[model samples]
Target chain A: MTTETKPGVREVQADDIAAKVAELCQTATHVLPEDVVAGLKRAEQTEKSPLGKQVLIEILENVDIAKREMIPLCQDTGTTVVMVDIGQDVHIVGGDLHEAINRGVSKGYTEGYLRASMVAHPFSSRVNTKDNTPAVVHTEIVPGDEFRITVVPKGGGCENMSRLQIMLPSRGKEGITEVVLRTIEESGGNPCPPLVVGVGVGGSSEYCMLLAKKAITRPVGQQSDDPETAEFERELLTKVNALGVGPQAVGGSNTAIAVNIETYPTHITSLPVAVNLQCHSARSKSATL
Target chain B: MPIVKKDGETRATPPFTDEDIAQLRAGDHVRFYGTIYTARDAAHRRMVQALQERKPLPMDIRGQIIYYVGPTPARPGRVIGSAGPTTSMRLDPFTPALLEQGLKVIIGKGGRGSVVKKALQDNKAVYLLAIGGAGALLSGTIKSMDVIAYEDLGTESIKKLEVEGFPAIVACDMYGGDLLLAGKEAYRDQPALGDYVSVPPAEKAG
Candidate 1:
């Protein structure tokens, strides 16, 4: 079943998308991304405190065990977050797109034996969804004929530490730095440092949060495209490490491995900043189909 | 049983006596070889509720260690999947009551609040820090696991686990020594912010 018969159009089966998402879910959970692994290795070398260094070593060992044993690096396995970029020239056929994604999430989580962490009613009974369904999917329409999907299984601990604040325009970069530092300081060991701090600036409160989430999905240590933003990322990274939260917050110089900042134009009277932290596991994977 | 210290590391099995806990100090690395019970937020809430309602708890938690973990489903032939500690501070609200019921050891990641710390000292219990996110490695330490109660909560179910050489650090000891705070204080650099920074003795001479 094809949606479009026009020239220059590519028809992608929704079932195929589900299969890819399912595969990605398992792989992302079992394997730590190379960039994050490298960041941890670097942290292990630079960490000062004995306990902090030992924690980094154990984390690296855990990464190895998960990869070798084909198991999740962390038990939380987390709420599956799917980011999809659909080309205008590409048509999804055979099923509803959102349902297809959720199907993939459920199948991957259940079949792969990952934890079912999502709860049905957050503020009520809080029953477990049982299959880790209803993934948070963000979709974008791009200019090409390619459909790309990125799966991020975000854990509860670090996600709980994320924060967003809408400040007066008068509070500029210094204010943003203060918020980020304070968040990191307050978080301490809970988020499982050394962390990858994602900073989103300039959008609305919600969009800023999304941007911060997107920033963390980028490869660790990859600077922003904007020159000024890249500089800001460096500055924030220096300040964050200076906090001496170190690996697992046992205390040393390696508090955060990277600070990725994403910014957009915002209203004149508002300065919205969101800080989303990714723990040491930092699991994420992508596929283009 | 009392804790045995050898080569600067403490080793112990469960059913910890007050003497065993008193032997532990903040920052002491411990390796356990015995039984532990697993429970997190949901199970803790129910247990606390049971206590409040004057109903008996499903399991005998006295002199027991509670590991705050909800592991993934184990694959065929495996004892458990990646099983690691969740954040402990989330269970801070329900902790004191558990301590009151003779809960001796709490194992998880991160620090606890002041009230929980005070409770730990008052009850002569200890808080141990398991390496967070090291689930796969931690799972290797579990020799076996069984659902003891609250099976309906799925992974949040209370499970009794037999473990061997399970490693952890004493984050908060019975004497009120707190490793998380002590670690940060020892390594934290002088504040860069003028308002928070103290004038160093060397800098004052300038």
Candidate 2:
């Protein structure tokens, strides 16, 4: 085949990535998303326990305060997680993509006055990374020349509550339901309820978790396009709410405002599932360049 | 409501005497004024290590409340950045030791472990809840901030905070009353008393 340049291909400077990533991080931390705000408002109206209602009310106030003042919704500004969808036709110039993203994270955290929560080592030392560099990046190449980035600052509390498991093929839908419910029950209020539970089924173990994490990046009430998956989400949500974990786990009916499920094809021999919980804050933002 | 400087107000700040803690119930709303200390996982690790070596803690923690927070840095003209409570469970390992040091109160979000609960009872201490994710709102209540120790740890460093109308609710009280548990149980036992319109039989029994 003869080599020829495509006419529609575009060049994107790495500086552009850094600048946009910084803004995305800053925006995600300072403002709770609109869907989440609406969800909390509805919870406040329907919350059954007086204390639970009061907690919901305070949470809404917190959102308002964070937005009006341009400060983070939570002190734990969280680990900077960036998801990049780079069009295959776009050529990124000026610098390495990962380095540019990290620089952007540092700039965002510093300029926005957000907390730096990352630690260097896991088992030993556990020193702070200072500027919150080296963000976790997940990238996908798609058909067009457009570049998109989604920034999710995931807090330690709810991130710690995330779980993964390999189940026997026999443990299908009912088994999945059992495990999901049990996870929320065991989680209680520690993940900072009311939680948004994200579940990923099938795929390899690692991809399963990635799916689960990505599920939370979607807006709070958005459900799967598949009818079967949406029904399952509704059922799991009902059972989770039935746990009585309530707002901040203090008790009421809103243990979980939503259950989101994402599925992928997997090897016949392997049945993997991952459950990731997003706390009430549920902060994320996205931009296309 | 505006919290005034009064002796019997439930929302009063510390230095809380044993009498003050005794009067508190699991669900009572309180507003903390005066000074409270800040620390999270890293600072707690260091403090617990200091305890092991029999070294004095960075500050006098006796009869004081330690808030689990690693705040965002303050911008220009701000006392502190978004300052809200972190999850308290991560500090569970060090809590009993701090309780032994006469730490009278712990403030953060979410529930504590059984060991911490036992420690609170033994130390005549209480664990309170600041609404999680309300950092910007809560930071409005802070009047001043000062880092006291572990400065290199950045956000995890030990700092002191002075707050006004710093709202909190009693989650676990000195008398072994756990509001989180009570709150869950109350709703489970009698659905009518809670905000839920209905409860399944399985959960009601469990």
Candidate 3:
């Protein structure tokens, strides 16, 4: 389908994308990404105890070692999550969209030395999907002809503690707070602290879950630009750290690094919420095509 | 509890005195003083079944800390590869029963259930949470590892691991200050005030 583009916008190339995706995959595991490293540095400086600061330093050093030595950041390696934003006019000429994404993930993980962590089932056998296939692809058709892709590696630890709730429409912010607090409180140290909590508000059940997951993919310390939503992030961040699930939850003071909140115009009848926790490794990054 | 040794064993068991444990605190890098035994979901099943039949355990539990790990097969001449802790929550069901047989220490990553916590307290034992993903760093602490039973369990089999002062963090101690709880409390910078998690130690690891 032909679509409009801005004056400077150009079509995204397949080879460029393949090379870029490979680099993004390798970079995702090897480096902490600028934002996350900065976040850790800030946490280190402001960290209260000598131990928590040391943990943060070790985390920083680990990131450095992976980058320098070209090793997978964590052994878990994580399942590949690809977020694609297709501009109004860009197209993939050589192959099917699904195949292209899968091909990229396969090459990236295999060549990058990352582990394969996908499974084929939900409740029953829970067999390993083997190749970490069928990447969790989120595509958006947006304003210009330039495409962008953000790949996130979601480790099993924090992902296990994720939760979604269908709240009474009347429940609102108070309900959101309760769900968030109870989830972290119950999680204790299982998710592996210090944690970054991502909250999804005002969508149907599934999308709310998606929002929660996407919220985590956002860079640390950046708040939702919407004033109301950003305020919610601040309020949530304060409350979570107050619970004291400090660094590694062995305890000191940095329970949660930040809380990112995203909301959508939802059905008047729905007040769904989802909480997706990201462990300290917090590996994610993006590239525009 | 009587000491039990398997037919193929080639190592001696080393017990730690109360002074040994007292000298250590949360987040200390001590090579584990005693020989640690390996068991995870699969091996625990056999242990439980052996108990039900009133059969002698293939390995003794006295003063032993059973580590919940299924290490990646050692590469070439390596003693162990990336040996880090897995979530202990999965083994929570089998913990108390094992504790009754004198399992004094449980080493793994992540927290355990209330049942396991109470059992540790009741037995005057402890639970240690090692750095979860520092598998390469942790494997370096082990002096040696040898398989003892259920060789067919693959990576999940029972094995006796000979270790020196292994780096470990006391997650839940005998009197019950769960480092998990204290760790959470100490580092939570901007927590919502009502949240009760607190860190136990104010100093960083040396």
How high is the lDDT of residue B7 in model 1? 97
The candidate, 2 or 3, that scores higher on TM-score is: 2
DockQ of each: 0.31, 0.35, 0.24
lDDT of 2 at A241: 75
**Candidate 2 interface RMSD (Å):** 9.3
Residue A206, candidate 2: alpha-carbon lDDT: 96
Worst window of 10 by summed lDDT in candidate 3 chain A? A65-74
Model 2 residue B77 lDDT score: 97
| Candidate 3 similarity to native, TM-score | 0.79
lDDT per prediction?
Answer: 0.88, 0.84, 0.71
Ten contiguous residues minimizing lDDT sum, candidate 2 chain A:
A1-10
Question: What is the TM-score of candidate 1?
Answer: 0.95
Give the lDDT of residue A214 in candidate 3: 83
Which number leads on lDDT? 1
DockQ of candidate 1 against the true complex: 0.31
lDDT of candidate 1 over A1-289, digit per residue (tens): 3244779898888899999999999999999887788778887877778898899999999999999998799999999999999999998888899999998998999999999998899899777788998899999999999999999999999999999999998989999999999999999999988888989998888999999999898777567778788777777887888787777767777888888899989999999999999998998999999
Q: Return model 1's CA RMSD, one decimal.
A: 6.7
Candidate that scores best on DockQ: 2
Residues B45-79 of candidate 1: C-alpha lDDT, one tens digit per residue: 99999999999998888888999999999999999
In candidate 1, the second chain superimposes onto the true chain B with a TM-score of: 0.91
| Candidate 3 Cα misplacement greater than 4 A, ranges | A1-23, B1-62, B69-84, B133-165, B182-206
